[model samples]
Each structure stands twice: as structure tokens, then as C-alpha cells.
Target: MADEPVLPTLPKTPFNGLGSKRAWAQANAPPPPSVSTSSDPAVFSSDDDPALEAYESARRHKRRYVGTWYDQHLALSSDSVMGDDGSSTIVGSSPVVYRPQRRAKGAVRQQKRQFRKLDSGVYMGGQDSTDTEGDVPSPYTPKYFVSPAQLRVSPRSLPQVSEAESAARDKIKNCVEYGNQEVDLSGLGLNSISAETIAPIADIAPIPLVVKGVSFEQADPDIKVYLYNNHLKDFPLSLVNIEPLTFLTLRNNDLTEIPTCIGKLKNLKTLNLAQNKLKYLPAEIRRLMGDGGKLVMLHTASNPWWTAEKLSFQAVIEQSDPNPLIRTPVEFLDSNGQIYSRFRLPLSDADLAESTSSLELEVEHPSELEMPKEVSYAEGDHVRLLNPTGARSLFEYALKALTKLPEPELEEVDYWLGVDEGYPKGLRETLNLAADAHRSGGLTCSVCGRGMVVPLTRWVEFHKTAGTIRVDRESLVPFLKVGCSWKCVPARQVVPECEEKLPESDD
Candidate 1:
């Protein structure tokens, strides 16, 4: 029985001692062309068994060919924590979260995308690097930043009135200075024989005697004196000897006439002679008023001077408005400093809006509006700014935009210099907002020719970081690949230099 089934003698392999040769033949032979992957796979149709489908759906969807590798490679402990009530614990320094992979059905994914090949060698895409510099940040992307362009710095001033000023005021015999600066002139009981407020300290003047904070001792005399709001009557004859006076103020005081010696101040640059009792100005003083331009400014408002003096300064005063909205004392000061009261300045944008709303009412009942009777309350700076023909400020521009007003001129690029040099904060904000609204869409989309709406919040930040056109917001936005939306911005088109043309070999 044992020798009955002794068939053909098989080839002597190392596995001959083993019972079976079928295993050897099967192992030695080539593999089949294909295999069935769906042999015992759990292929549950959603309609077949909703309960099992739901159970499987709640489970994490493992990525093909990658999940097992990550599971084997990542040797962390299965130490997930749960709360007492079977909820995920939310507290702890190292709270571990196991998020499920959510995927859409019937989606196709690229295999082996994590791997990449380069000239040097194959590597993981995460670790793949090139010899060139790193990628640049996009300019249009919203970044958290702002420019100091909107901010206005204040001008430097003395902390308090100097001891010299206090002592000078103390030298007066009759008047007492109050906190509110209110004076009871009747209580002083002094007769109306007015004397000069500024008098010589001693019988004879020293070479450089300082009076009202002006020291005559320094040569190339700098008349950096601000003698406004004083009770001075007569002109100091000593001022006539000075070769050239750069500045002089005879404003807000009681003066009868301009001394003939004022002509001797050949270099009298700025002369503020407003709110004075001068009935007449000398012919020589007229000559000293620069040829409109040579004298940058000459303020002579609220003066009882004859029409000739007012007429001479009127032209120069108007020219002082280099940019209309930005004003100076010379530009804003009218015949009786009445312009400020007439063209009202609002405290804020809201105030401006309210003021603009009231304009129609004022026009309807001009007689009912109480007008300013005198210029007694006017400060040295009368008006904040004069309006452009169309829009004056941000609030005005917004209001005018509703009326379909054409875009007005914007502040010059260098206008920021004025901001840095202490332009009003409110005005700066208004100017910045107006500029943003006006120049918002000057730049076109990268893909389309339609203008881009630059985000004002991040406009300056984008301008600052944009390597190609990192200039002011206005000049910068145009060059950037900006757009109305993300869709409009063209994809970054990288053009590699084609070194296709090679020179002939000259061996």
C-alpha cells in the first residue's frame, strides 16, 4: 500500500525532505497578471443597511497606502483621555485630540503626492527644497498694520509761561492777573492816560537788553518775538536801529500809528498787524511789505487803517493759501476776522455731517441765523482750512458723493510733512479718509483692467511690504497684483529665462 502510489520522482530540491512539492512549484512560478482587491472587502451600499452604513460612516476614513505606515511609524501610546461623563476632556497642558477624517464620497486622490523628484535626488515633498530664495509674501493679502500717515504730530510748545513773562507782567502797577484772565479795570481805579507796556529796565539800555523775551545782544538779529495780546501803545524807537528785522508783531494791541522808522526794517519778513487801533500806515511801511512773494505772509486784519493798508495786504494774504484747505492766520484773517465765524469749522466728522445737514436750513432762513457781531473772540488762527471747489473734507466728500460731485484735488504727497509738523489731528484723519475714498480704485486688477478696491485698513501695510513698488499707498497699489476680489487677481506668472541661443564653439 505504501509503494502503490509512488509516482514520478520529482526534482531534488532543498525542500525534498518536506512532504509536498506543490508548494515549491507554486513559489517558483511567476505571479498571476492581476488579483481581486474586492475579494472580501466590506462593500456596504448606503441603501442596503443604513445602520451598518452609519456605523462605518462614523469611523475615521483611513487614507490608502499611508494609514498603516503612519500607524506603525508613530509609536505613541493609546492614551486618549475622556471626561467622567464620557465627553472629551477640554482641560490640560497636553490635551490630545483625535479628529476624524471627513471626506466626500467618490473622490479621486493623487497617489504618492508626498514624494517628489529633483535634479539632485528623490525626497519627501515636505522636505523638498531648491537652491533659489524662499517664496515672497503677496502684497494684496490683508496684514495687520497701519501707517503713521493718518496720525498728526503736535507742535512743540513751552510747558508754561516763562518766569521772565511772569516778572514782566508783575512790573505793571495796577492790574491783577486772574486764572480765567478776567480783569476788573474799574477796581484798579487808574485814569485813561495810556503808557507803553514795554519800558527800559534801567535809565539807559544795555547792548543786548532782553524785553518780552527778545534779546537785542545777538547779532544778525533774530526777531523770534511773539508780542501779540499785549497792551502796548507806542512803537519802540530802538527797533529802528536794527539793520533787518525778520519778524514783528503789532497785533491785538492798542497802537495809533505805524512809525516812519518801520522802513528801516529792510528785511521785515512777516508782520502781523491785526486787531490794532492804527488809523494810518506810513508809505515807507508799504514799501517794506515784500513783493507779495518775498514777504511770505503779512497779516493786517481788524485794523482801522485806511483802505490803502488793507488793500496792499489783501493780495499777499490770498496768496498765502498755497493749498486752499490748509490755512494760515494771513489766509483766514478777513477785514474783521469774520471769515472763521462765517465758514464754520466742525469739531469732528460727525459735527461736519451735522453742519452740512444744517446748510439748507441756513440758506432758507439766513436772516434768522445769529451772526457774529464782533471779532473779539477770534484766535490768531481763524480758519482751519479752505475747501476745494467740490469737497472740503472726508465728511463733506461722503455727503457730496451722494450729490454726484466730481472728485476734487487731493493733498500733495508732501502734505504729510505738514501732518508731521503738527497739522490738526481731525483734519489729518479727514484728509486720509478722503484720500482713501478718492484714490481707492486708481489701480486696476492684475487680470482685468477694472480698478482694484484697496483695503484701507491694510493699504499701507501692503504698500510697505511690497518689494517691487514699496512706496506711498497711492504709488504702490498700481504696481501690485491687486484685484477687486481673489478671483480677479491673476495667478503669479513665472517666466523663466530661455538660454536657448548658444554661441558657436570657437576651439
Candidate 2:
């Protein structure tokens, strides 16, 4: 067997000698020399050639950094790098730590002096130059870090107008005119002068002649004269001839009667006298006339006279031969003397005819009338005759006789029926037609003439126990029966037992 030799390992060092040797060789290597050829023209010559020199000079004049060594390797100048065009590329460089520059001794002293002035409360920077020496001291406390000479304001003074100037400013106080019309009352105590016044002040003007808590004893002649001539419902005339009267209103006055001498005033119009206590009107009030003899419009609603029976003030104005100038309340008087004030009252021909017929019937008949029953009555059936013709005629004669009798001796008709008072005139004709239909053979029973034999066409079987019998299209249920004396015994008399066992043929 043969033995082999091993290679030795190198010791580690801060710089590898192999790497250092390679780097040194690369740094010392010389650049390749340029070639020169005369036949290839001056563009191909080396730097030593004279023609190459001329070409190099021309190239240096025309050459640019476009795709050249400057574009690839040269760093941008600081002036170009800081330009605002934003196209300058920033190259990374090693960052150096920055240190602030030290201030000069004079500048440091000046800063220290300002801080000392501020700290000592000798600051003057914030105060106005024109501020007086006697002005209030600022409330700020100085700080140790600041100079006492540095001035700063704690509370500032605000500009303000003088009290005398503020008081002299003019403002609106009261109204002097309304709707551009002057309020005139020279004859009254009101001043004739015009001035601008507030609206509330203008509205508070006093009214004329307002008396409170006073009663009248036999109304004064002046008051009556003022009332009639001025068309006033109630006017107080303690001393009536007073002047400067333009408007008068006496609403809700408790005036029970009017004076006759009230037609004297010739200068009055537009009086209001609503809600008074007047029942009857004075005849002298009708004489209220103007310069052309036309009556003035009067307003007297809500008075007791409005609902009076005799001499309706409203009706008198409505039925006057010449319509007066007064505004009368329009009321439609019904047949019963009721008044309806609606503009379009519901009135029809049927209602008028019914009212007229009712009046005529009341006059002809003295008692009320009942409606006729649909059930037919047999002859001698002892039925109660409602509003019979004989009874009505007798009542009318008795009523006439009673009218002639003295009040003390006249006897009242105790047996008088109250059913005939409102019967119509043709009721007897209807009764006669009903009687004829009942008498016809179409509804006669062979066993008992009183018991009607209703035809099959007129019979309506309402139930097994109850049926409706019709005669001439009128139907009735027989609730009451009138027994014939020849067929049945009377209630007071009883037949023998043998008599009760009648044959079925006899039923």
C-alpha cells in the first residue's frame, strides 16, 4: 500500500491576501490604447495624431451627456439637485450629524435682557403707545424664564362710546298717525299737533263720555229725542245737547220702554242698540226720517220685542206698503203662526195640501179620527164605529149650541167621542167601498152570513194554527169573533149535555 501527502490549511486574517492581491491588480491595470490608421480617415486615428486631435476637438465641442460617460457616472450638481423642476435625481450619501451654530455674546445678552424684563413685570410690548401711565396695571405675573423688560398684556381695554353720546341718540317712542290718517280731536282735549308716536300709545286714546254704574229715572227728554232721531235704541241724555258727537253705541242696555219725544235729532245716523230688554215698541219711533224722508236702518236684535205676539216689529217691516230703510229680520210665518227664518225652507205641495185638509177636517169634525181597520165588519156585529158620520154631525151641532150657551150653565158633552176631530172629507166614501166589497157573494159563508168565506185565491196559510183572510186584495187576521145568537148560546146561558154533542155536519 502507498501513502498520500495532505495540503496545509491557511490561518484566518482580517484581510485575505488573495482578495487584496486581486483588488490591487485590478486598480493598477492600464487602459487599452487607441488605434490610428491613415486610410481609415481621421475618425479612426489615435489621440497622438494631428488629424485625430482636430477631430477630438470637434467632438469635444459637439459631444453631449446623452448616453455618454457623464450621464452614466457623473453626480448631479447641488444647484441642479435643489431645483424645483423635480426631475433631478437624488443620490444616496453618508449622513453627517448636524450641530446648531452658537450664538454671539451680544445676541445672548439681548435675549437674556428681554426675558429679565418680562419676569420683572416691566414688559411693554402689548400695550398701545398712546396708553396713559395711570392706566390699570395688568394682572399677569412674570415668569423666571422670561426677561422682566418683555411686555405682555393681561387684560385689554375695549373701545366704547361715551354715555353722553349714547343718551343723545334718537329712537321712535310713540305713534302719531295710523294708515297715514291723522287722529283729530281739537274740540276735545286732544292736541291738534302731529308727531311720530308708537302704535300702542296711539291705540290708548280715551273715549268720550263713559259713565259707569248709573240708573235712569223716567228717561230724559233729551235722551228720547236723541234715540228717535238718531235711531238709537238706548241713549243716555243726562245733558243731551252736548256737542262733538260722531259715533254712538248702546248694546245690551236694559231699556224696557221708549219715550215718545225721541224724534228731534236731525244730525245723527249709524246707531247700534242690540241686546235690549224692550217688549213693545213706541209708535213715535216710526217717525225717524232723514233729510229725504227715508227711515234710517235700525239694529234691535236679541230684544224681547223680537218674540212678541202682537205687532211683530219684524212682520210690520216685512208687510209695510212701502218697504222701510230698516234691516228687518226675515221670517216665514207657517200656517200655525210659527216663524221660520231659513232662506230656503223645505216646503212642498203635499205638505201645504195636508195642512189645508187638516184645517178643514178640524172645522167639520169636533173629535179626532182613527185609521180604518183592514178587517171587514158584518151587519149587526155590534162593532165600535170610529169617527162615524152621525157622531161627527151631532158633535158639530152640539159645539155650535154650546157656543151660544152661557159659560156657567153650558153642559159639557161627556159622551162625545174624540176620534172624529181630524177625519178627512172623503173618509165616508172609502168606508162605503169597503162595505160593498164585504157584501159581495165572493166572500159570503153559507153557514153563517157574518162569518166570511174567503176564496182560495185570497187565502194565505201563514201557519197551521193561524191564517190570513183577504177580501178585495186587503188581508186581515180574524182575532175577534162575533157569535150569532141562532148558532151559539149566549155567555150567560148554558146548553144541556146532549146539545153539546152536535153532529159534525152542523159545525
Candidate 3:
């Protein structure tokens, strides 16, 4: 009778009509062990009990979640609308409280739909969905930089620096050097590098010098600067500091506007600004279009804002491309027997080879840019020279030279009369060079030591071949009304070649 164990009783709610199956299962469950057994809590009342060790081993040591769920009965206040569409959802603007209520089956659910009306039928959804497809951002608007900022590397997530960068840092310790005049750096365009900190070389070279982005504000007067593909928006004023820059490559950039200060680059010969987002040119930039009678070869074709008239006037040089002027006027060719697309001085094949070979050595290394204390000018150096204009600026000197020349003749010189009416072949060729120089830009007259003036040039025009620029004619231009004052520039005459007949084109 003592070994017959009593069964556990089932709860009243579980044994009710709808839950009787669950209650029956509980009623047939095994009975608890006798109170004195090791499994019973009564025997493990104190730590001294042997059963307490087993209980401690089975207990969980981790912290348990102690938070409560939002109450199912709670609600926010909201307004309702009756319409053809029998469904309702939650709206976010101006929330209102809703009371709990019993509803019949198949009734439209009265859930709130958070929405903002942007247009007639368009609504911006909230809470349950995102509102990313709205028309707030337009295409032309500057796209905000969406990448993470990297001012400095975190100590915990430091990236391994390649051995080459470390070696360049070692070699690039001193930025200032004067031996060969070059600044070459590679793999230094990363976040941690800066021009000032990396080296003291602020003097830019007139040749190719590849380095990381450097501060141009205090840069030296460099030329032939290649800054293409820099993803730039604003043209740096530092570039304005490069006073005598000749060949500047600003291709493939996001340039919107150019400053009038760009007119300062007086000696700039070739300006390559293809593939830019330019809308308009500054009026002062007209100084680049041979306005001051300075020869400026331009390549501004791909600019979106360039009009057809302006593009037609764009100048291309023979040194770069043979056919810079794609289209030719038939009248100009019809007048002369010329069949060439562009005007260029014919060079012997040996001379062409020499020029190409020199270009290869033009790219100077950064280590070679250390300037020498006494910079020596190369031989055969010929720049515009004046008699005695003391401490004059480059532009001022040029102005003085132009004004000092003699006035041209008043009578118009017929181009065809001199060539067809049996004038000396040597004289016709000389006039052609003078016309070329007058059209291109100024080259000082060898005799007068004066620069060419506009409308009526007093300085003699000369051949632009790889030899003598101007022969003779030296005087100061005093404001005078002049026209082709053909005081023929006296110089040694070149041997004339027989003119060839033009080959007819098929109509």
C-alpha cells in the first residue's frame, strides 16, 4: 500500500469542454518522486547538501531577457475616410488615438496607413515602407559624395602600406632639389599624402612631372602642365600663379567656369581643354584668341557651350595634328593652288626624327627637379628683346615693342598681282611668310628690334621655318595711322622652289 504513488491532479481550465484533450494528457503524466529522493528540492535546501551541487550545475549562468512586449490593446488616435476602395491603413501625419472594438468577419480592416500627398494620386508611404523614389533630387544637381570620409586610418583597422610607397617616402624626403628640375612621385595620391609635407619642391617643371595633388597656391611658374583627368570642379587659382604656362592640358574634367585672371598667361601657346563641362567663356579669356596678337593654338572643340562660330575659329597647330582645321573653305583654296588642309613649314625627315627624339627626354623625374643655384640658359636662346626698357614686366615689354615699330603703307598690296604679274619668285615667298607671321602672332623684326602691331604692322614679316624668324627693321611705334608700309624687310634671300600645279578634285 505504501509503494502505490498518488497521481498529480489536472488544472480546472485545461480540463474544460474545449481543452479536455490537453487535460487528459496531463492527468496521465508520471507522478513526482518521493520527497526524500535526491531529485526533490526539499533535500537541497542548503549548500551543504550533496544534491545542491547537482542543482547548481544544471542552473543557467547567462542573464535572461526581462523586457515586456507592447500592450496589444494600446493604440494611437487617427482620422478615417470613407471611399470606393473599402480598405484602410495607418497614416503617419497627425496621429490620433483609436479605441479597441469588436468587428464582424469580412469587414474592411481599419489599420492606419501613414502617407504624405505629393501630387494628385502619388503618396509617400511611411513606417512599413521607405520614401526613396520621390522627385526631390534632379539629375543636373551636384550629386553629393556618397562615400565614407577617410581623414585618417583608425589604429584598429590600419591598412598595410605597400613597400613601394614606403620606399618612395624614403626617397622623397626632401622636396626641394635643383639639379635636373623634375618632380616625379607615384602611388602618393592617397589620403595620407600632401605636396607640402612630402617635399619642399614648389617649383613646377615645364615638362611632365607626375606627383600627388599638391597646393598650387604657392607653386612656381611651371609650363606644359598636364592636369587632365583630375575630376576637378573648380579651376584652382594656384594655376593662375603659373604665369608663363604655355601648353596646359585640362582635358576630361568637370570644369564649369573659367576665371578672367586666365588672361594672365600671355606666353601660353597651346591650350588643350577638350572634354570639359564648360558653359561659357569669360570675355577676358578673349586674350587667348590672339586678341593681343599673341600666337595661341587652341583645342576647345568638345566644350558643350562652344558655339559653331567659336569652334570654327579654334586654332590647331601643325606640331600636334596635321589637319587641325577639319573643314576648309573652297574659296581660299580656289584662290591659291594650295591643296593642303593646314599651313605648316615642311621639314626634312631627319629634322622630324630629331624633334620626336627630344620629346622623349622631356619628361623629367622629381629627383632631377632640384634647381641649381645658377640656372644656365641653353644656347641659341632667342626671346623678344627691346633696346632699353628697364625692369619692365613681360607684357609691358611686349607692348613697348609693338608700339615702337613703324607704320605700314596706306595702299593695299594685291596678293595675285605680285605672284601672277611676273614678280620675283623669292619676293612672293617672303611676303607669304610675313603674312603668316602677321596672322599667327608677333615675332620681332630682326632689323628694327620691334614687335608686330595690329591692323597696320610696322615690323617686317619673315619666314617661320626652323631658321631665322625676323631679318631686319628696328624702330619704336609712335601711334600712327598706317597700312602695309611695305618697307621690305631687308635680309638674305632664300632659294625659291618651282611652284607645282594643284591636282583637280572630282566634283
Candidate 4:
């Protein structure tokens, strides 16, 4: 075989990487001829030329680009012409129709858009600054009718009362007389008392006191209210307004709970609350204890109480053994045999959801909606706050500021000293209302025993005793406990012997 002949090689071009051969050819091509700017119409109106005819036909089919507003107006007006036969015909090319790009998902029209300028030095397009069509009515009207009077809410009316209720109300209205030291309203078979039923007492003026079978005629005497053996389920919170009440009896009723407003009774001495269905006492009841308190006697016996065993059933626990022996109150047992209060609040998830829904309907603020939730424990079984953030409200802040002031300053401002003391008219009334909104100036921490306007840690404890108030040996009453901070609340776990003390012999 003959040896392969050597093939001639073509020189590489610098623009070879330009991709398309047409682009490279166009880059090396010469410029096109310029059009003749002639005034002769006969030179351009040659019908025999097919290239000119093809160009004209293409130009007629294609829309012309209108660069300016004036150009667009001129092209639109000149594109059509009236023929001799009284018929309209398109004479020139039509101007381009503007089509905007599709907007993004949530894109909104610009409120203040820039106006487009015309060739005649005038702004041509944009929305007007004012809403000119605001008063214009729609062409189509809605068929449904809604009355303006129907939208107006009427005042809520009181519930219908039965004949027994009417008789009880009339009796309660006339029970208290002027200068009378005692108001007996027991054995009425009344289920509840309203503000209207207790309104007549407010009209009684203070008169000279004259007691029978006694040598002394006092100028004034405090009132004693007796409502024993009634079917009252709730304590009459309206009685907190009565400043002169010294003695009160609500024994043998179906009272399940007492309001924290009971602490407002600064002048109350003896209170009989026996034979009721009370399982817990508000922490505000502590205000009625000690020498400063006027309450000398408090009867809280024969009520179904929340004991350790009862509370332990509502607790959440975790254990490795399947059949673990659950302890009462579910807290560590100390060497002294005293158990720390670490029981979960007896509130179910359904109850919490219902309460939250109700609050959402009634309350407007988000902070107000944050009602107390559940509590959890940390790694060492120490109680930790799951909800209820340590946030102070505006009212709490104001109350805290007023409490921090010195006694002399408080007195100088004519601040209402006690519940019996009349709140001074004007600016002091606001302070009085603010202070009364939170009875005894807010809550008291159980651990540190310090007054707090806003509690940082809130928990429930089944206590055996309520201050110095004596009860039956088997009774275990629930008490609401709070702390200024988590640090103040004691941990549940018992301290290990090693952590408590150093190794004695090894040392």
C-alpha cells in the first residue's frame, strides 16, 4: 500500500467559537443601502416592482411600534380613512397595542404611579390623586335588605324572676332599717342574691343608736348580716361594698367557692362558713389572719376538701415499672416527713379550650387571653413554668408603683387608707378604683411571703391548714400558691446525702 498523502490543514479563525455560522457571516457583512429621501411620489409608487409590492404588503400586515403618546395618537387617527363611497377603510399601518406582563401572586396596583409623558411636553397617563368615583353608585344593586335599626344593639334585660324570687327580693329590700345594728335574712330559701336585692341598704342613713335593756346609747353601730340556712351557691360579692359589716354568717348553704373579694371586709370580725361545699380557700383569705386582721373567728368545717389522695389522681407521672406505687401529692418525702406541694392543677384540656374560646369571644387584648395554663417539671423533677410568662401588665405596673411609695406620701395625697375610709373625690378615686380592682394590692407569694402585683409562678397546693384557722384533723383544703420567681419556689426532689454533706471519714 502506498503511504498516506499529507492533507492540507486550514488555519483556525479567532471567531470560530461564536457558535452559529450565520452570526459570524453577519458580523463580517457590509452595511445595507440607505433609502432615497426623494420628494417625487411617482418614484416610490411603481406598481410594477414586486419587491416594493411585497415590502408594502408586509408593512401593512405588521403593526408599527408607537414610541410616544403623541405618535400613538397620530398613528391611531391616521391608520383609518373615509373612502369616496362613504365607507371606512384602513389607510396606513396600525399602532402597537400595549399588553402588560402577568403580575406575581400577591402583587397589588401601585397607589401612586408615575405618569407617562407625551411628546407635547404633557403627562398623559396615571390615576388621579383623589378618588373621584367614590360617590358613584354601582349599576347593579343588591336585593337583600338590612335595616339600620336592626344593627343597633339594645340594652340587655334582666332575667325573669319567679314568685318566690319576687317575695325574697321584697323581703331583703325591707329587712334592714335605719340605725339597726342587725339584719336578719336567714331561712328565705333564696338561691342567690343580686345587686338589686341588696340596693336598699345603701339608702339607709346613719342614725343615733339606741339599744334596749342597755344603759349606753351609742352614736353608731356596725351592721351584722345573717343569711344562714339559705340555698345560696355563690357568696354575694356585692357585700364587699358594705364597709360597716362586722359579722357575717353563711352557714348551711351550698357555697362551693368564696371570692377573693372576701379580703375587702376590713371591718369583719366573726365569719361562719360551716356546712358548705368548699374544697379550696382563696390565698387572699390570708389577709384576714394575724393581729392586724379584724377577723377574730373563722369557721370552715364540714366541707368536702381536696385531699392528697384526691389530687394525686389528677397528676401526670412517668415510671419504668408497669405497676409502680403512686404516691400522694406525687412529691418527694423528706427526712422530716413533710411533702412539697407539686400537684398538677385540676384543669382538663377540654376545660382549658372552652375557657380560651370564651375569653377570645370576650377579651380584645392578646395579653388578656394568656390565661394560666399547665405546669411541667425539669430534669431533676423541679417544677417549671410551661405557660404564663413572667410578664407584668400595665395595671400591675401602676399598682406596683403606688405600693412602693412611702406611707407619708400616700397619706399626703389623701389616698384611701382602708376599705372603710371613703375614697377621696377626683384624682384619688381613680387610684382607689385601680387599687380595689386588685384586692389588697394584688397577690402574695407563698415562698417569700412578699406582696406581688403580678405573680411569676402560680401553682395549687393541698394544704392541711389555712393560716391559724382550725379545721378537722382529716381535712385537706386546697390553697392557691404563687411566687415572685421560680427561684423562690422550692424544688420537689430530696437532696442526696452526698450533695448535702462531704464524705465524713474520707475527708
Worst 10-residue lDDT window, candidate 4: 105-114
Tens digit of per-residue lDDT, candidate 3, span 343-413: 11112234323333111222122122111111122343422322221243343334334333432220113
Candidate ordering by TM-score (highest first): 4, 3, 1, 2
The better candidate by TM-score, 3 or 4, is 4
**Residue-pair clash count for candidate 4:** 0
RMSD of each: 34.1, 47.2, 27.7, 29.3
Q: Which residue ranges in model 4 land beyond 4 Å of their true spot?
A: 1-156, 159-165, 202-218, 313-342, 347-456, 459-476, 487-507
Worst lDDT run of 10 residues, candidate 1, spans 103-112
Is candidate 2 or 4 superior in lDDT?
4
Please write out the lDDT profile of model 2 over residues 362-463, one tens digit for every residue: 222222111112122243333332221122234333333443444223211211222355554443332332232232211221123232211101110100
**Which pairs of residues collide in candidate 4?**
none
lDDT of each residue in 1-507, candidate 1, tens digit only: 876875464344432222321233442323221111112322321112223234344443332332233221111111111111112123122332332212111010111111111111211111011100111012221121111111111111112333444444454322222121111121221212122322221112123545886745643434333456665566545554444346666567777655544656676667777777764444344345433222335565676532211222111112123321111011112211123222332213353345433212121221311112211233332322221122223444342342233332233322553547675445544445334433321323334434322311110001112222122222111011222322231222111122312222211
- Compute each candidate's TM-score over C-alphas: 0.20, 0.18, 0.24, 0.42
TM value for model 3: 0.24
Q: Model 3: residues >4 Å from true position, as ranges?
A: 1-222, 291-295, 306-507
Quote model 1's TM-score. Answer: 0.20
How far off is residue 260 in model 4, in Å? 1.0
lDDT of each: 0.30, 0.25, 0.31, 0.45
On lDDT, the stronger of 1 and 2 is 1
